[model samples]
Target: MPSKSSARHAALTVAVVCSAASTLVLTAPAHADSVRIHDIQGTTRTSPYAGQQVSGVPGIVTGVRTYGSSKGFWFQDPNPDKNPATSEGVFVFTSSAPKVAVGDSVTVTGTVSEYVPGGTSSGNQSVTEITKPTVTTVSTGNEVPAPTVIDSRSVPSRYTPAGDSAANGSVNALTLRPARYALDYYESLEGMNVQVKNVRVTTATDPYAELWATVKPSENRSERGGSLYGSYDSQNTGRIQIQSLGATADFPVANVGDTLSGATTGPLDYNQFGGYTLVASELGTLKSGGLKRETTKKQARDELAVATYNVENLDPSDTTFAAHASAIVNNLRSPDVVSLEEIQDNNGAKDDGTVAADVTVNKLIDAIVAAGGPRYQWRSIDPVNDQDGGEPGGNIRQVFLFNPERVSFTDRAGGDATTAVGVTTVRGKARLTASPGRIDPANAAWANSRKPLAGEFVFHGRTVFVIANHLNSKGGDQGLTAQYQPPTRSSETQRHAQATLVNTFVKSILTAQKNADVIALGDMNDFEFSGTAKVLEDGGALWSAIKSLPKNERYTYDYQGNQQVLDQILISPEIRRDRAFSYDSVHINSEFHDQISDHDPQVLRFRP
Candidate 1:
């Protein structure tokens, strides 16, 4: 974990419990005379010697992190205690480059502290550290601690035990049962040198010079060699993050199905991003698994293909326009109507009150034409300046790209960002009052989020309603390694509200005309099994089409090590009752390091 800032350390003058189950223990003496590493790192999440001084702590340096904001050297005690719960290693925070090398026997005297990354507001567990240290090298050329093998046998199949119910579901106070739970097993060896051999890469190498691999290759493994995250209960415990302690340029690039051949030795450190990360002093050799991107079949003559792609805050200045265009044209097989999310304004985050995305959309259309695809016409409403919650001044909103030759846009006038779209009966058919209109944009659910863009289109002379949405993100949700068991997801409130509003709008359309063909699709930003999806599917208004795919193949986004679904396409009963439609989550981007966007695009093909 990163070193606790001076401000945070100063603010934490007294012992502060990291979890509800943690309490300040004054049972130990005021100051430890000769404290071992395991003595300082007790059996719980918080050290018993926290906020107390320890002198002459002896250990051999296992790894030295010379870069980043949190520069420190990890050392492990040569002799371990009888109990397996207490860790025999600890991180000595130096605030800068540490003047230590691996295999150097050193004696450290410092204050034992628990440094919580991302502050206490983030529900992350703290990393035990010794801050403001005075280091003395006792000897040189001493051997480092023998690396512990973290294979399938070491990591338990069970992820975690139930937290103490009285302590707000916090497992901090619970004793570490290393053999029983995977989380406890990792926590027991925190800051200790560990090794993994012949591990399969679960997530591709990211821009941050990091990758994820799993010790247990078969645990919820996807067909494409990724660990699938199907539900909240099944967080794959064998997956772990790996980062190099060397230069970023020296780090090897890898894909999802790649393998880390040979032993990769590292100190297991806890961080804010991925909970337990191995900062590898010795990186494994990257062996390609030959994983290739997938392509979906082109829509047939009678089928109307509708696709959704989140262009990851696309703007005029981005060089990824060509790649994104290729993905839509080649990978997605050129869908008839594509819902594009995160299309930035013309100025592209310049903050000059420019919210129009005509330049952006037209540029993409031109690129699509250049890529030998159909000339797609676009329709979208410019959101209020800085009102939509994305990159500040970017004004990210959803746009529709329709093949004019295959589909005709129903352009009813007078639709703006704040105007609410309603359904009305026109010649015994359901018609949107404003074609390409916002769905309750003024509602509190869309306060700082992208308002759902509802559009009316005529596909092969049949009227179809498509509502494109990019709901509130899961920015503040607690991670799987949070201090509390079943961490809180405060961001779901807004998404649930937004889903309810969209569901009501769909019901209104169906109420106007019973068998109206309606398809609501975009970056839902929630899983298929989430409460938000349930709300959208409530009252039988719509059903998520992605559910048709088998559980292992239902992912559109890859996070850390788990392949999960954050984007969805929901269809009305009239369209889904027959089960004749086809859905494809084209995995062109998420599992590759050369991705233009982080999320893979999804396509739905049906006759409307």
Candidate 2:
């Protein structure tokens, strides 16, 4: 009964949920005449009895969701069937406030539905539901079903089944194998009351009032109390999202490594963000990890600081310029040079073939100066119309903002939007033939993507080569919540190719000058541990500065419940061997809900 907009919004939510799956146990009543919740849920993501009327569906109302488009109450069978594949509980979508109380044993009649919360085009899984119920309160004050305990042993360590060809890889197929796969496990317990004990927070609490946690220790556990979000092959099945069904205020603000001990009891619910979430009515106490917002690093006159930040599609029309500028100046300590990604066209997303970003760059520069930061001189090669893949017509590309007082750009002739930059030996030194030139623009790896912009600058009388990159994103790749366990990371293939191209260029620079100071940094759109990073670091030509930090402090981005590294700075051997480098993943944006960009900028201070 949700309105069109709310249904669309909910559909989007479910679409996000389809990215991953969780584990749970379900039970059915013994009565043959009365339809069980499992019968409606079936084995696939879609319900078997969808669009059909059913009578005498008996359950105890465990929780009620009165807010949002999904205003309904959840009920589950007290006498659960022995089948592990079947879910004992189901959501009764009333479309409005339902006259149901917790602990009330009710026999209801309604139509079964497979509702896609985000709408049809969202590519999300359908949540089986019962709608338009005519309820009969069999009794009040009935005991609720005991919550299922989910831990490392109870939930499957593996994330997904090997094959999803059956039932299109949906939980609705009724082929629940909770012991084998995590998705199957969560699907089996969908809507059932569940409990997670002694879990550590894997993702920080978001404004959406949800947090992801790893139940017990995981195989890819990080030193700082959270599990590493490994490659797509490893789904991190131990992790599950936690949602407070009662009050948003009750949900604790927690960071990665924080602990939620005692009994966090709630009903298993499926939504768009995290596939399976524990909608807990009773949340345990949160043990803080002393994870505080980091302060700006001290900058020295001899140290040349370089930083990479994804502005998240900054345009002239957007109003986040001030916040972003403040972060750059205050949080990043006003780095001498900053490689900025996602600088949109002048008119932003209007897409009217206007590819110039002078207006956008000027606005940001003006803001940075106003925010107690040094005035920056910007350089960029505008993309050929809408060739760059991003917001339609936005023409997002990478740009360099260097403080004129701290560093000077080594501008050479012949650099244009389409021409590829080459490493040339000038006066027996490795230097870019065309400063601020694209790296292999004609290469297939850069097709429809923002090509790397190579700029030469002089810092402390040394020629330093900087490559600003905004590589192909993980757009077509499956989300972690994908129905297919071990979701496909189709985006990595392109990123690997892109990394190879950059590495080749770095090798060319090293060939010209063995001790060339080369720094490649930006949003690579791949994790540090990914094969793409491995390819970039091949032959020791360049090293990811993030890896130099402690294992726990390597992330600059947070997705789902996993603190990850998407933004990075890679330094050449000459710079690395100098051993006079300091790096910090500026924790200004990614962990906070009120963030200016989804990515937290990373800074590297070194004396060349």
Candidate 3:
């Protein structure tokens, strides 16, 4: 027993209310008051951060710091009621952790008091005994919305009182803003369909994720593609739960055979692929407010060029894109617009179970330049941070290719950012789980999964914008066959989410730039008649090019005993005005799957 003063110091208590999720999570105690500590006399757990939440569950440390000959360092638990962070938490590593090896999903949680002199950082303000989060282990409840739908105009809205950092940052390090939570960035809204107005958010720090958006009336009444996907985002950075922006499509609603007008930002006409030959033009902000549609010309004589390829894990081991220099360039053969799938970001090693693929996007640039396709500059990708997808995801793969020579990126993040916030509809709810994902004291989820990358692309002289993507493979099984079918089981919602992400981007873009030539292309991971492709066509998202190709020449991938279509190039009526564009799946990689990648490449050609 201690005196009054000492009693007050040891008064912290912790409790964990069990939930449907397998594990009961722990919240840190109030600041200043550290967890109590005491070295266990005899136990095999000789580590320093042991016996605390850092051990995999939330608990009070026995003491601040304990040292033993072989046991090394030791930390006492402050709260006995709290368990460790998780079973395989990413924290509590045995050696000095390097900054580069911080493992994207690897985050330590605890009090960020003054450093312990010999600690990692100077005035670090993070928890000492951090246990990195895991994707599988850190589960949530009812994340899937109970299917539902609504008109684009009936959605609701909430004002998030602005803060000092609310304003967009400078052009150099544009502070990419995350989707507003008050707007419902990640709450379940399956039954409530909504339409989100497209908003443009430019920042220097966040170039790939400059735009953030929300889908109002997020629910739907039926499974129709348009209705199947109310509104969704790929970045999963945050959710914007709000009522539909009372907006509707009025202009001769852009559809097949329709042309789109061009967008003029300043002195430049913006893009060439747009104009009368273009399809549904996206023009507005997906961030907030209602997006009003504007009907425009339906016919243009300009031809547009588009291409989609299954770069087959384009990420090379050494992070060099030059590996395929011969195929990408010298190959004009090199497309005017290219959409690549399987681009990766570096986080950590890929051996064992850590998904943090060492390959990153910079390699893509190098490869393109090495292949001599440097004429096409840089563009945008989906996920803002590659560490851990905003949602409960371990792998962090994204897409963002650009052509500085044509369209210019206004709001953009410089390199990589760990902040949870993003611009407009460009980045919605984060893919990471609601909670930090560490399951134990050692198992930190590494970032290493691939997701589609969609962004505004300007067609030089044509004024058209393209939305690129890479959908979830029907799970990428080697046993896939022409007659094979797997209903959203192994990777059901995974692919669906990819489609939904694509739909949201298209709708938002059209809302903002009505009649702008819009192109949606990529390796959809599904065939022509697959549910994934149907959803895209049904939503009037794109006029798929393969629909015109003969059945024998339609496939871009064939392996095991099956031939399926994985790459596609679709265009909005705005970008497909008349016969201005022609597209076909290329067999360069597919023919030599073993030598190159496993998927095929699709190319589109149009006269700007």
Candidate 4:
């Protein structure tokens, strides 16, 4: 058996009492040696008397967890201790459904145990519980404890404690300073009934029947009605996850900027998905935010339109092709040229020695035409087997799709999947020697990463160089819900290095020709406000087109409660100086629950 101190912090704190077994009203006086629920919960995650047998634990039954494998009930002390650090409630875990009723005052005799939900190997937190319980009814028809009121003021303004120097620095430690950090505040109330009133939805409802809301409105709010998600800032301190404990059908479908009018009363619980969640039995009515999807941009014949979309690992066997093709054609309005990312090998995820993506690309083209769009011709270089980092055996790579009638690809010889592409000056203009070639394929920055694909295209006698990229992803970065204060973005170092290489290549093109029409676009995998993006925008060589939008509206991806920017299209100095470019974040996905991809495609129309 593992020691209780070694377990992570308790995620759930349920306290329950035994009900009357017979019709006879049991009237027994409280025992003098009875242990309080607050003492069992203590100020820390592990119970003070863990692994020891305790008798006469008294409380009123509050809730019953009848469904799950760890069937248990929650009980709370009617008169809680005045200490803010110690919680007044705890969970009693039983092997079977607890035969208890709300308002039943009972004394429990059980062995205190620290129950890890997913076992020791999962790295998940444990729930402090009392197992092998024997219930003895002390009295019947007792009043339930009043719920603690929670609002902006009750929640601390600080999002997290200071580094390890602070008293409450350790996230798993029981030393909670509820008055200082919001995480500590929630931890202090773990498993206790709390009420949140007049909250605004910060994120759209997820498929798991949950939504995030802000207790108090802030200045950085979106027009759609939710708080704008700041990057690890204390401004998002009051944001909390709201989960419906009942049926998924009982949960209301809502978008950001929506309102939950009445007070939502629930127990404060912690889980692996979201750090702290309010498991609500009573939910407030949802009011619409009046948010609507944006209209597709109009295409002009005088200018050429280019788009970048991450199809999310498209393969010949996947059924999402039709939906993605429909989005590209109907939602994005069929740009003259499109830079596609995450195109998988012909066999999809099958690890069979297949490295070709021709079948996969053809299926998407056929889907585009079938969806009432123009016929699109594709060009790409097959990546080395399992060298590019993505799904195993998927061999995901970047490809370009263009309408042959509108824009023609300037394909030259000597370009393969592994070889690097070189830039040359032709007729006093900078161009790629190979129409579709990899840029610095052997660069250490692109180790186990997708190489940038450079393609030269001509639309109406004007030459434009487009570099399609799928930079390093945020795979190994610490999660926002991690146990660390201001979690580190470990993947950014690689992305920054990748950005440097792309910036160097763009500088070479500009050095050769002062006013080259260059457009770099794709899923860069870093935010527009991130340092990785700054590396790509150094010295005015390229300008992030997404920044052209208003500060509140600049987002192409939505994660948690934040509408953030991950995919971007950066243009050269000539394109930005002319002021002849217009761009739109075609909002066909990312906001809705049934999205074709996690990202929304971006389109840029400019007169080169």
Candidate 5:
């Protein structure tokens, strides 16, 4: 992987490549006299010059990356080419930092290679690089090529071309169509200097000093100035990741809706994360949009307020307890019942055998009371150490927080992480055999993931079944900018099975009693329109409450310049039949740079 720095020299240039270290197979070098950078790039995702040797490739050094394991410098040919399908710039991969500086015109002889950023299995497009180069500086202080402007007119409305079926839906062999597809257009400008003026931020700056902005500000934009990923077919092409090539410390901290005023100049590059990224050498001024965090109105006197929030691996070592408590109290308005996900053990990521989270849970409860909120009580089962997949020894799980004044917990005995919970009939009414119990814990579907925790709660003498879940994440899924046209979501298989189990459990409860109130809510880690959600809503077992809001306001997470729905609250017919429920996806964290969590909390209010 590439290294990051906080300072830069007088020559302003951005390193566009975030390449992984790779080995090259040396062979006899061929003498190709008529080859240029564009000829090496060809017009496809893979270069036609791949595996072939070329000599006397001439270009001016535009950027020099002195750090990172894959130390290299990007050079651009100043000569003009009529075809827009081919890029004039390419990176020369040197084992160590190249002695060349920016504006140095040099001739290189090397073998053309395609390096995949995250390995071949990532499905990401390979980067065209000249590996094992012999560089000879012919002149110094030569002018670099002019940067191409990236605006709404340049990027296409279409995302990508249809992949070839013969290659398992891979677009790697497709010819470049710069004016038609967005991915192709970006590919045409790969490793070349580009600029975007007055771009609107779609995703906040993350810990890696990277942010995303949209060239087409009005294309499928949400009301809050963000691009919406409503479905697989609507992949917005205007969004592009922005990372600084100069000083990481000098990168602007931006939030969604903010503007990077003036021209942000950089070279267009492709990486493992976010597909097409602009590594900025010259940054623009940041103008705040004044995007404030949203607060939900207080629930009515007779209404039951239930919320789901992923605390993002909360433990005693975390310092965001006060801010999180304030968000729960003032921003969320203190829901009657709050389902918390990613509640880590007391030691956080320590690999100790301790699985109890009493210290972690108690600290948050105390902070909530200190923030002028209710005296909340939490209930959760400790999992076996190193079994649940998370931050190593974090042992992250779901926990329930209920306000004693507005709700009452019905605790049944013999509930553990390994034991499965089942529904039973008590006096002709549906009830859980073990309250605060795991749902199908031993099932293969939940192998390294958090099992659903079923809890029995009472609101004004009405029984409500709440299942908190933190399903397996979409870790192995291919990205939208992958070499495949429609990226494969390999991680969905486990989520589908997990959802099916939850749906089956809900169906079992409803079968025991016709009008049982059941609410399954948490970080589903899948989109609302995904197949996983379809399986959960199968046989009319439950309906996603997030659909109650407008399509533009349905997202509970912002990722990679797309406002999407990953966390949701699905309710049974007993809760959805009556149109008395009000749902709010409170926008507190996902849109802000200084966030306690990456997911926004969701609240559902209804009268039983």
Candidate 6:
């Protein structure tokens, strides 16, 4: 047996293999450059097959765990193992499936990966092999300890902005077919817990430069007047996310077929169109058992609880993601979870004579951190290719910004760190990503039905998520009102449809899962009390959060001189208790907009 190293490295992160760490041996007939990790916490490893199909070329699933589905796991191995470990760091396969019994070690063929961030801890890398290895039974492997995978499935589907996938079948490609919404039942589950597996998602393939993520939830009925549900719960219909696969980690797919093992910490939630889904939060797994505080118990401040704000269309140059992030980071009235719209999309642009998205977005993360934003990092959509045969401005739009120490998450496929909201798409899979003359025609079957841009995140230890967004603008001011007067323009029709879809989605979540803490916010492209506003309010959801506040404190964005109330922060029943309030509408990049874009911004204050 090769002595396994247990030296704990702390640079990067990677996925785990089984319960505890283990010692692994690679049998290669040729001299191959390999890495070995030693003293990995306490895990051990060993090679089951010496040299057959795996040929020591670094491939195969060495272990398996049952979380909920038969998914794969990889131990982030940086260097090859040559010695013994002080502790153990076995790759863990969570609880759910057939189950990995004590002394159960299987030798298979696949690619072993350097521990990845989505893995155990830092200084690690993860491997998602192209080919899966065959599970060859071996001597009963050492029984390694298991870590907890606290579930977050019931956090409500309302927070998943316009691109998360589900099994509800509400949408057919980019378009949605109509039926009895069952909208009333979808409300109560807003903050509950559920699981979504194997979700294949899509997003707006718009080849634009604006840092935007426009989402639409449902369709058909609410097409008349816009609604907040569509905007807030846009991605709940199980569609495409520029960056994510669907519903966090494709749980529905995992749930339906075979799976490892997984559970829920919050209430379980499901949709008519989708199966089960939940918000992402700190895992209860790998319990350090050291003075840890549960986020679910985060207290609400007495003066002003932290509120959520969605700054509409806040695109600045790539150089300002971090430093400029602080400009909006510290809200005047203050908020715990500040939901921003139109962050900064980095797809493809000639920055210093080099095509770069990470170059700019990375700077944003650095700047925000330097500004003392605290452990705040970012995730993005790594667009397949945004080169010409492209749109004018490097086709990129995303939503990202978080207090690192305050939240934890896993990244899916996307562009840059900030613009990960919009991934490389084959077509306009969203609210029109690849429009005409841009990157060729795209998949816009659900063009007008874009869901809100969102992710499963945690706030103050509480398992909460945000659906940040901005919808189609009121294209032009005129020609809207042949049937309806003000707020109606030809260009605004699609924009209004965006509103209707959002409204229905939000209402559905609130109806399905009551007693949920949800916030449906962003630029509705219209004013309050108008079509979009009325529908959201009539849905009984507004009664919980924002409506719970005094009227004067509701508006987030202001107009020229009059208070048109274009931006807002709507909430659900569970979150209404936070006593949320409006901070102030803003113009973070006044100089830029003065130089480029249009829309202003909105800011809100929170107290949790």
Local accuracy of candidate 5 as per-residue lDDT tens digits, 292-380? 99999999999999999999889898899999999999999999999999999989878878899999999999999999999999889
lDDT of 6 by residue, 413-514 (tens): 331322313212223211212111111113231242223554544544443434544554543342110111122244455555555555555554444444
TM-scores, each model vs. reference: 0.95, 0.84, 0.40, 0.85, 0.95, 0.38
Candidate 6: stretches off by over 4 Å:
1-323, 330-336, 347-357, 380-391, 394-396, 410-451, 479-488, 542-561, 577-608
Candidate 5 CA-lDDT value: 0.88
Candidate 2 TM-score versus the reference: 0.84
**What would the C-alpha RMSD of candidate 6 be, to one decimal place?**
26.1
Clashing pairs in model 4? 14-74, 14-90, 14-91, 15-74, 15-75, 15-90, 16-74, 16-75, 225-257, 226-257
lDDT of 4: 0.77
Candidate 1 vs candidate 4, TM-score winner: 1
Model 4 collision count: 10
Error of 4 at 77 (Å): 2.3
Q: Write the per-residue lDDT of candidate 1 for residues 463-549, one digit (tens) a residue.
A: 999999999998888889988887889999999999999999999999999999999999999999999999999999999999999
Better of 3 and 5 by TM-score: 5
Note the Cα lDDT for every prediction shown. Answer: 0.88, 0.81, 0.34, 0.77, 0.88, 0.32
RMSD of each: 4.1, 5.3, 25.2, 7.5, 3.9, 26.1
Candidate 3 matches the true fold with a TM-score of 0.40
Error of 3 at 224 (Å): 36
lDDT of 3 by residue, 533-564 (tens): 76776567576787776554566654221245
Of candidates 3 and 1, the better by TM-score: 1
Candidate 6 structure, TM-score to reference: 0.38
Give the count of colliding residue pairs in each prediction.
0, 33, 174, 10, 0, 204
| Cα misplacement distance, residue 277 of candidate 4 (Å) | 0.8
